[model samples]
Target: MTDPTQDFRRHLGQHEYELLEDDWLALLEADVSPALLFETAELAARYAPGEIPKTLLRVLADWLGEKGAHRWRLEALRRLLALGEDGPDLPAR
Candidate 1:
């Protein structure tokens, strides 16, 4: 049998990634490193493109800003926003 979480992680397309933002946030709330969160976000973004939600972006932005590393969040946000604006080639959310 497959590990459900691993399977979920492996097939995390944009819409699914967006849905999983809550899980990511919970991880963050549990005190996971900002760097790790950022990496996970990047992976989700690459998989799902424009599917990330604004709420998740704001959370990430706040975290990065709090660390005085706004550049990282800004860059990632820019990419996500651009993707959102242009629309992704994935299935409907």
Candidate 2:
């Protein structure tokens, strides 16, 4: 079966994609380091960051502080990979 996320982003076009990307980047805030962000550029490019939760975001920030940039990126991708759809994984409260 094909990945639906691929189809959805493609439909959004490059300009729209960049704009949506900016939204996701904002989610990371100042807690995450620029180096880690650059390292995980592929994750943001390939997957959706908009679906991340606040607790998870904090966890990612802490990972950067403790584990260093590269390790943090590996962990981030691993965490994000757990979210199957990546559209809006926030749980209903």
Candidate 3:
């Protein structure tokens, strides 16, 4: 099946995809854009392509929460919830 994540970002072409891949790789290394990461995770979950992305989303959500990025963490949790994950337990502001 065609990857929905790829389809979602297809309009940006391959260069953008490459850049997103780079961002994905650098997720834990630096202060990556939480919005972009959340988008990627959301797309990955909506597609339900495989386990890897789902696992990554879970990890990313926790990481964002720990990093005190509550908004992005809630977004990630929402995406995960759409995939039938446990409901979001958002932290206070």
Candidate 4:
């Protein structure tokens, strides 16, 4: 079976996987749909969290809150928790 995250992974630009941290984070702020936001968050988690910007991390957290309920929001909330920022409350899984 194919990886469930592959589709999300594909949403990332080549720059993101290249580990050009600045460009990667910038994509998060670009014109992307909520689905892309979920993918970007997942991509960042795959890398060293310490390398990600706190501002962008918080931005993702806030987007998840403002974007309302999508299935990925719950996963995003869990990942954002590792960034030590408060995100919207999600029901216990």
TM-score of each: 0.50, 0.25, 0.56, 0.42
How much lDDT does each candidate structure score? 0.57, 0.45, 0.60, 0.52
Inter-residue clash pairs, candidate 1: 14-48
* lDDT string, candidate 2, 19-75, tens digits: 543343343543445554544444444554464333344455455556566555455
Candidate 1 deviant stretches above 4 angstroms: 1-15, 53-55, 66-93
- Look at candidate 4 and give me any clashing residue pairs: none
lDDT of 4 by residue, 8-90 (tens): 35533343444434444455545466666555565666653454534445566555566675454566656656666463453
Worst 10 residues of 3 by lDDT: 11-20
Q: Which candidate wins on lDDT? A: 3
Q: What is the lDDT of residue 25 in candidate 4?
A: 44
Task: Give candidate 4's whole-model lDDT.
Answer: 0.52
Residue 89, candidate 4: alpha-carbon lDDT: 57
Write down the TM-score for model 4. Answer: 0.42
Please give the TM-score that candidate 2 achieves against the real structure: 0.25
Top of the candidates by TM-score: 3
The positional error of residue 17 in candidate 1, measured at the CA in angstroms, is 4.0
Question: Candidate 3 on 1-93: residue-level lDDT in tens?
Answer: 444345435623443433444345455555557776676666555543556455667788778889898787877776666666664363333
